[model samples]
Target chain A: MRTAFYISDGTALTSEAFGHAMLSLFPMKFKHRTLPFIDSAEKATRCCQQINAAASEDGEKPLIFHTFVNTEIKHIINQSQGISYDFLDHYVEPMEAELGIKAQPKTNRTHGIHQDYNFRIDAVNYTLDNDDGVSTKEYGQADIILIGASRTGKTPTCLYLALQYGIKAANYPITEDDLDNLQLSYDLKMHRHKLFGLTIDVERLQSIRQERRANSRYASLEQCQLEINQIEHLFRQEAIPFLNSTHASVEELAAKIMDEAKLERHRY
Target chain B: MRTAFYISDGTALTSEAFGHAMLSLFPMKFKHRTLPFIDSAEKATRCCQQINAAASEDGEKPLIFHTFVNTEIKHIINQSQGISYDFLDHYVEPMEAELGIKAQPKTNRTHGIHQDYNFRIDAVNYTLDNDDGVSTKEYGQADIILIGASRTGKTPTCLYLALQYGIKAANYPITEDDLDNLQLSYDLKMHRHKLFGLTIDVERLQSIRQERRANSRYASLEQCQLEINQIEHLFRQEAIPFLNSTHASVEELAAKIMDEAKLERHRY
Candidate 1:
């Protein structure tokens, strides 16, 4: 059994995300350890020792995935016996050459909270307050209004967009009544330019609803099918771009919506 | 004016996050462009041309921040006139030398959604269902229960932890009755081990509350101060680990809670 380490100068999310993605491609049985906020040289030395110890015990060099901007700390970890894949060192030089500019390397900056932190916080607040069509008081302030049948991955996607990109996203649930009427709500029509729709596979929708209310009409496959069909039809008729959320994760959904809507992420 | 580009073989979040962080440190005006999912040699060639054109127009080399796993793509982009900072080329060789293994170069693996995507979605569902002490049906299933006064950043943090880390977090608001009585709810007491408290500065809390209901008794500064004091006292008496969310962003708050509680993020 081999060991894999994800180390970073900040929250280590990038390293962990990259490592998991890469490991998924290879048929390897490995134990993974994540070490974040290794911002100092001393911490880097200790990390190297840990990696070396793991390598010795396993009798196989461990794979280390790292994203560190600090050169001194990266150098110290490079001396470790484990095979390291440093994210910054590998791509910075070529990018510098391509751009005709020197790269600026800094530790713990990638995930640090900057001046726009408040903007992200406000976005989160706006998302929560406007969730599930709870209150339309803030609709005028929303950057995007997500409309979907209940449990089509609207709330999670809205929160993800808000938290990650500081995008003011508000989600409105498309109820059975609205689907029967086959019309967009007056409020949605007014803000139609900001409206994005989400739909899901019938089976997935039924299963998701089943988890909330089992063996009921709401959770029945037939009901899910009817709702999905109407919602897709409404989307096509209204010319509002919609995505099938059954196969897409929230991140993919958010990215797709942002790209399609030409919505700029308010990150600083 | 200068052009700054974030280029990547995958989602480009790492390159964008790093570039933004580094640029924040320097007082320079730059127009930023992010190009994600540039996974092929053809895409790389097009990106280089865009960078070159921008450089020629601006009469200054544009800054390119890139994370590419493909060596050929990286080499092609490096030949461009713009200043290129390639994340992979600088560190992969040293790491390979140290670990005696060749780096597996692949694109778009870092942020790929896999089987764990369902787990994250389930977590988000759980969090939203249990938010703001609305339902105790899933309190028994919560990995962590965040308790705080209103407008103290409980809901957003719970959502962030769930969406970003796949942690099933639930939040319960400390209402006026609970504060006046200075006691935990029976449900919260039953699962005190999972209870985590959040407190904010009195003034901040007042302002946040004022935004929701301006000039009301509930939104008064005195009410916020009284509630905070009571909550802090209750936390100390009950030996509940709590953090001050007044100055911390949701990301920082989530990380601190996960670390303090030793809760493993269930992300795949």
Candidate 2:
């Protein structure tokens, strides 16, 4: 049988998706297999050796799709004589060429120049910095603070903004205690001008919460309704620009925040 | 103030990611905003109107990055006066033309003859009845199944697959119960062949779990090691091919499965 091996250095998810997508598009068919290696260069080399041995024993030239960033694995594969393999570098190289930007497809950037600002901003927001029992002036450092009940897509939106836009986004949950108080976090209130609120339909929030907590009190529809209404009222009374996350995706919500905050989308 | 609107039918997360990625490569900065609307014709029209108003008020022809798909929005925008916009259709059309594909960039499939047999095989695999109950025989019906422990990137991988691929993949946790029981769920066993497992290093899983539930039994080093060892033994014993989810993206994970399972990847 004609064989195609999908070798992965990190995870093989993208490779598998692309392989399936490509197989669907192409008219040809081949026996397919995947080998996902962890952060080990040695394991990747061993896997390559296994593939080469299998191909040689079968006396068939196997088509290999190797996806990895480890130079050791690459060197081993390049030296292998038994199997005919193609690297995914061919498919990804063009996108960079066309886009006129050099993004390392395999190396995920945690922080650097040309990284998504939205991701960085969110990363900065979630980190805690406290002094004694009281909060410090950390709130003033936030570019924007998102307040909403759990399951309102606050965290994801904050992350997307910080990771993709390089905007420093912070988010706080409107816990039952916060709802009862009908006020922003004490620390957040100090920087209330930068605070934004996210409110979603109780029914929607309930459904989302249910996915995580099943039958917990936090996932209860009644509790969701009570909290959403109180949060909305508090946001309006306090004049925090609020958004309904009922039907919006994280991308949509972040977009709404950028619009309302009049913030420039910092790309690089 | 030059305004740029990134409008999309997708969840705002993707819109913002694409917008930010694109803008990162651009040379100049503009007043950026994202406006997300549900699949309402009126909302789309109103968004177009808002773009026009914003552009006119700013006295600069705003570069409206329209990520939406409704033809009516395009029709309305084309009919409107004094605004410039870049539709995804036009943006990818030249590229499509260069690629010699008569199909549009957005349209996924062509109407005509049967294409790849491998995709047809995947279609059949989902339909085949299995004697084992573990087989989500409807595994084909899964948007995505994430098989991992408490913190082996299962949830994020699942969310990414669902959000990015729009695949209806379902995820099942491989708990101690499943392992002690010596088999996956009846439905999963029946669809065992369709099941794609995600494996990660014990240390990595522990660290991630610790972030969510610190100092707990589930997050403990010894507990994590045992669970990982047990789960890995089960995967190996069952002969279920798996991937390590460490440092791999959801895109890569889902792609790997699609490739391994030989499923069709639909265009967004």
Note the DockQ of each predicted structure: 0.32, 0.07
Predictions in order: lDDT: 0.81, 0.57
Candidate 2: list runs displaced more than 4 Å. Answer: A1-194, A198-237, A243-250, A258-268, B1-144, B167-195, B203-225, B261-267
Candidate 2 accuracy as TM-score: 0.44
TM-score of each: 0.86, 0.44
Judge candidate 1 at residue A230 and give its lDDT.
90
Q: Across residues B1-268, which tens digit of lDDT does each residue of candidate 2 receive?
A: 5665666544333344334434433444557766654356777778767777876787766555544445666566555432333423332344233324443223122111133322322322222221122355466676446575665655444444443334455567777788787677776776676677788888888887787789999899998898888888888888887888764544466556765666544422
CAPRI quality of model 1: acceptable
What's every prediction's RMSD, in angstroms?
3.6, 12.9
TM-score (0 to 1) of chain B for each candidate: 0.91, 0.54
Instruction: Tell me the docking grade of candidate 2.
Output: incorrect
Candidate 2, residue B217: how far the Cα is off, in Å: 7.6
